[model samples]
Target: MIIQKEISLKPKSRGFHLITSEIYNHLPELKEIKTGIAHIFIKHTSASLTINENADPTVRSDMETYFNKLVPENATYFEHTLEGKDDMTSHIKNTIIGSSLIIPITNGKFNLGTWQGIYLCEHRNYGGTRKIIITILGER
Candidate 1:
């Protein structure tokens, strides 16, 4: 079976945010799947998706800090800066991180590690609502 849905996430500041629960909460179909895979894709170029530490909030903060340092805004060579200083940098960060994730599912639950969680890599300063397309493929 294949199920797909698009969800809008509340806007967030530029950072790495744990959205594991939020994503799972939107997927009622997941409960019916005995085993499968979940494909989560972000619909914006300024944002991306990833999986990482879920236990400590510091991890998220650290990730944001690291990425900002790695991809500073207003670079001289960036041509896509009409949106804002963060615009071009956001795209670069999205490329470095990615725009989607594929995770295993089992017994109606995501097979993530104990400390693993889904993260929305919001790179823009005022990134509005993010739209995610979640596709679940599995067996009953």
Candidate 2:
């Protein structure tokens, strides 16, 4: 059986937001499932999904800084700027980070490596509410 779920999230900042726990907590109420796969997807053009280290806050901060440097907000060579200065940069970031992740599951639980976590990367320079799509596929 494949179960699909969607979650709405409000980010407090303009960067990566750890959301692994929330998705882990909302798996499902099914039984008889042994092996499965968890697919997480972010439904936004200006944002992305990243499965990375979530144990320390510094890692997240450093990632944000790195992306900013990779795609500077006020570069004088962008074309899509009707939204704001961060609009084009946000799109660039999203392209690099991607928008979905697939994780293996065993015994009805996600199979994540040590310190591995799921994050919603908000490239825009402001807080906003975004949608997360969670899908589980397995035997049941």
Candidate 3:
């Protein structure tokens, strides 16, 4: 069976947010698939999707800090400044983190580690609702 759906996430501030529950909550069809793969693709350039530590909020904070330092805004070399100071940096951060994720689904649930979860890396100061396309493929 193959299922495809587009989910819109709520607006979030600039930071790494755990969104594993939100994804599952929107996809009730996942329960029908005993073995499959969930391919989640973010439909934006300023944000990204990644799997990371879900157990601690500090991990998310540290991630934001690290990335901010890694890709500082208002740099003299940034040419894409029409949007805002964070425009170019957001793109860079998205590139580093990526825009998609593929995870195994076993026995109707995501095959994620105990401390792992899906993260919506919002790189802009006010990244509005993000859209994601979820494509599930496998056998029931």
Winner by lDDT between candidate 3 and candidate 1: 3
Report model 2's TM-score to 2 decimal places.
Answer: 0.92
Using alpha carbons, what is the TM-score of model 3?
0.98
lDDT of 3: 0.95
Q: Give the per-residue lDDT of model 3 (tens digit) for 5-92.
A: 9999999999999999999999998998999999999999999999999998999999999999999895789999788999999999
Point to the candidate with the largest lDDT: 3
On a 0 to 100 scale, what is the lDDT of residue 85 in model 2? Answer: 94
lDDT of each: 0.93, 0.83, 0.95
Candidate 2 residue-wise lDDT, 64-95, digit = tens: 99999999876899999999998988888989
User: Which candidate model has the greater TM-score, 1 or 3?
Assistant: 3
Query: How should the candidates be ordered by lDDT, best one leading?
Result: 3, 1, 2
RMSD of each: 0.8, 1.6, 0.6
Task: List clashing residue pairs in candidate 2.
Answer: none
- Judge candidate 3 at residue 9 and give its lDDT: 99
lDDT, candidate 1, 35-114, per-residue tens:
99999999999999999999999999999989988987746888889988999899989999999999999999999999
- CA lDDT for candidate 2: 0.83
Kindly give the stretch of ten consecutive residues in candidate 1 with the minimal lDDT sum.
71-80
